[model samples]
Target: MFSFEDYREILRLVKESGRYATYGEALEREEFIIMRHDVEYSVDRAYALSRVEDSMDFRSNYFFQWTNNSYNILSRKNRDLLTDMHERGHMIGLHFALNGMTDMELIRRRIRQEMDMLSDMLGFAVNTFSIHRPSPAVLAENIKLPGILNAYQDEFFSFDPKAGPDSALRVKYLSDANHIWRYGYPDAETIAAHPRIQILAHPFAWTKKGYENEENYRTLIREKYAEMIDSIDGECKDFSPYREGFMGMLT
Candidate 1:
């Protein structure tokens, strides 16, 4: 298994080298791809992502769950690192577990718990949220919940095909976990480049070459960074710093 540090190097090449492409450029060249990752407490993976940020000289959103053992969300080290990343301009969002997907009240309570937990651990309020293992039905139903989904803060849902484009679909992304682009979900580049900000990632996915793995699902993630980074090289612009025009309303 490739360590997270290896992943960092991949990102580094993209940001620092300028050799790495952006979504904007990739689209024009017919090779647009975006590199984003969701870290469920896989410290090694997270570390690699951090390195990638360092290498690229840019920060990408990292969604973390509070229930995993890879790293304790409450650990001071975890808190400090999370806060440090945020302070350094990286985004930190909630990785909501499946249990919290059903009940709005439960979701609300859980959000508070998660936000408070993260705040206590990282010394900041957790606002943004993304659901893990979100099924289309669950996503649509969750959207109907009163104070969950988009209520507390930004809710990250992998594109809901049923909800269609008119709904709150924001970012589009796929998991590279198996060395292949997660073909089941919506296209991430389109979502990222959308009017609203899109958050996407799969920390566990990568190929040895650092480009995206298209040949087969193997254990090489770093190798495909070039292809992945190049894929998004010009398809869209970064939506970081978060535009405030929405006024906290879920449109």
Candidate 2:
């Protein structure tokens, strides 16, 4: 139910408190709030939020999933959007899922392989990464990549399942997962309480209009549905003339 305006307020709070850095810049810092977004459902939504950040002259890390079923990173539309975001000075990186693999060596290879592929597609070096919904085994591995900065690395994050918003840990972690604040919402007080924090806000949960929770998801579904129809129109000449009518249905 968060509006882009609400998101903007959070951004302003962090920026004013301001020891925040992009993953690349934070590598040199002792304490920072790593402003990050893992694009989950919609690149279009990510683009919307990125514009908000851009308007504020703010920059942060954005991670895109390589194997995401929701959107194709290789598609021309997505490639252009992602590359455009990078050109605007926002850090782009891989949002990876270990997929339950436990062998540390094998995990390293998998990460690098995808990293290389993602880098090639973006036409830039993607040296930072964040894991998507890491399981206990994935966290236990503490998977490391050479010459790369992992957002979940022990130096930046400490995983404690029972940890709460007020719990004092090595590093504070706040997330906007499942469209709900999993830790504590970073109000002025909540944010000031943590010296070192990592904020994982998903672009999927936000919008320009910022509808109520149920309507927000319904809107996303319609957007995805239209994207599917557009793809169908591209590959199926028979659907070409029908595209507008199908699109109108959603409208």
Candidate 3:
């Protein structure tokens, strides 16, 4: 988990250290960038990151899951909001939990259903996806593997670290049940050093000027949302990949 301070420090380091030169060079040479987040349990973080993206004038894919208390498909408000976000120019993707899909047919079918539901709500078929809770060993093996993610616009939307070889950039992320960035965690610096673009997911668990405070947390969330919208209003750059499933790793 990465705290706000941790991200700030990373920003500072990237700005000060020349290490980013290579990364920047790669971005220019490759003509692309990376910004990904897996929205597992709730859209709270999705909303937060939307703000962050809006602030930075950046747009990235956000994978959201469907389950009780996670994202109630029954909520018309939620559906409309998600759709509006899509119309506003953000990628709405599936965050699949397929660990129990022993049957390949079942896996594809489930994926289709999820994609259809999300896509329909957003008035378009989603092409991108990221898994929830797939083990690292599995992830590494999956990085390069292929699968049928029916109803998606692109197969590359699937984010799998397991399908490929080991990476220096990927690091251990000790986290709460739902992935969220935690600055309070001590190992954030170590995890941040990894080159793999790791997403920090967090539920809206309350915020604090000093410690956990629900009211203040809610306020911060509101403020951040407003800030994010304002940020997007200023300027934005699209960094989605040109090739369907390719995003460069700073190796």
Candidate 4:
């Protein structure tokens, strides 16, 4: 059961391991673990995770995708969530999506545009970025944009060679993508043994209770669609005919 309690236990183990460090701190520490959360969906979920981290006095880098329509980054509710996370010492980063874009120049332009927008919205400079489902070409290029640290770059941290590594770097990388641990479950034993590690957990993969990947996604979709219907109905109350079909579909 990969519930919130499980996550809290992981953090507790990391604290006991005497090797946990934030991504920024890992640069100087010989032995450390970098905790990273990519906000693929549900800022509320991310906020919940942040609270757990806060309880442990731990810090992590949270990357948010502006291109993701699953949650509005600019919405008042989400903006407040981001602010709360930032205030609690979690690093806010831009999760850039390539979307099969091959042009380096255009990619750089888009990167800067989103960085500027996010920084302005957060009222602070966002200095880190990670590519969302990057293509082979982008990975090969390893293009570094100005003024932000690339989370995918080798310069950040090395992965341990033994752990079915993903990047060229020599650090142990563990990921919970699609609500399943791709490498292996990052338990206390695994965490204590590794000198340097990178833990990538998607906020949407976790909930207060255990849920399968498909189930979690379905819940998010239903909630977002319901919210959209409410917004539309509120804006066009006079146009009952236009909303009837949409409301019926939702019901």
Candidate 5:
């Protein structure tokens, strides 16, 4: 949750469990633990984690937001990183934003549209998506597209508002949302117990030093400043002349 080594430890634990599987691979297996990373803040951070997994010969799903204000997924630098991840056998999926609308049909339509657009942009079919930060209503809806895999679907995500406590899980779900282990940290024993598991980890919260939440945001803000400076320099010729003044403080 904090350090890259910490993340690697979890990856190692999952791999050694002999139950690890990708989402697509899960389609054929009953005992599978699918590792998912939602690119919440930085694709760079996501790519770093991807590299960590790659070093261990592990592949996981990485979902990126097309509409995120923090990072531009369509940017050339990001596209290159994404392509590299895909080339290395990592799955790139869409991190969808509902934008406040909860209509099931409309959500379905928009997901397809975004996936198709992202797929076209990346030159690879994005066959899956994970909701950015879902509302309870969205979870209850349990949306599923014809050919696309919804990360929140009943198969992977078990949720039923009306069913209340009676609703049982088909696949155990765990998340490092808000930089905390929401559904009991996926420890060694937990991983061994659950046959079908889906883990959602955000790459942005982790760093080499394992900074605290406040420290993490400060780091992200500094990164954002560098990104904005580059963005302006790229978009406007005049900005380049004065770009050095701000860029100098990045370190």
Candidate 6:
């Protein structure tokens, strides 16, 4: 039942604790919570989640994948959504997809190309990135690119209990992957126990009404198809001659 209400409750707990901070702000603080969203499915969902966060005066980082064809980041509709999120005080970052790429030099090249393109499209400089479906080798390397903060890097986050004992700063990370909270939902009890925490939620996993993972994808596809049809209808209206022909073809 991870609906919008559930999301609101999570924010309420974070606000009550007064430990929530954006990724950039968290870097400066000794102990803080980093609320992040990876936009893998729909920008519309991201916008909806951003509105929820706005109501609670909470700011988080949204990392978007340029490689994902499900949503066009450069499209006017999505660009507007991103702009709205930015205006609402949420930071935007790159969700870089290695796609099992093993070459270090090639990885760096692709990262720069995508980051620059995305930054230009958003009219903002993206300084942070999170690897999308990173492989074991990529995670082990922990390569840090210039001018960008690596979310997966050891310096920023760690899940090792042994590392926690050795290092002064400890990072507790949790994520909602495949519509399931693998590490369990971050309730008040969980938040209180961890001094430094990172909660990664995917916007697509949440909805105004609770939906299963498959239902979320179906809804998005339906909406996208309807949007395309509407655009075509609008264009046909301008060209009266084509309107009749297009309508006939449908019939």
The regions of model 6 sitting more than 4 angstroms off are 159-169, 234-251
TM-score of 4: 0.83
For model 5, the local distance difference test gives 0.86
* lDDT by residue (tens digit), candidate 5, 52-114: 888899989999998877888888999999999999999999999988877878988999999
5 against 6, candidate with superior lDDT: 5
Per-residue lDDT tens digits for candidate 1, residues 132-163, read 66656545554433332331121333445665
Best by lDDT: 5
Considering every candidate listed, which one attains the maximal TM-score?
2
Clashes of each: 50, 0, 25, 8, 0, 0
Q: CA lDDT, every prediction?
A: 0.50, 0.84, 0.46, 0.77, 0.86, 0.79
lDDT (Cα, tens digit) per residue for candidate 2, span 1-251: 57989988998999998788776666678778888899887899888889999988898888989787788777899899988998998889899876777687887888899999888877899998888888766776776777898888877788777777667897788888877787788778877988788898899888887877789889999999998997898798788888889888997
Q: What is candidate 6's lDDT per residue for 90-179, written digit by digit as tens?
A: 899999988778998898788888888888889988888888987767777777777777787775577343443235446877788987
Question: Which regions in candidate 1 have their CA more than 4 angstroms from the true location?
Answer: 1-36, 142-171, 184-199, 206-251
Winner by lDDT between candidate 2 and candidate 1 = 2
Provide C-alpha RMSD values for all models, in order: 16.7, 1.7, 14.4, 3.6, 2.5, 4.5
Query: Cα lDDT of model 1 overall?
Result: 0.50
The TM-score obtained by model 3 is: 0.52
The estimated TM-scores of all candidates read 0.54, 0.93, 0.52, 0.83, 0.91, 0.85
Clashing pairs in 6: none
Candidate 5 ranges with C-alpha deviation above 4 Å: 162-168, 233-244, 248-251
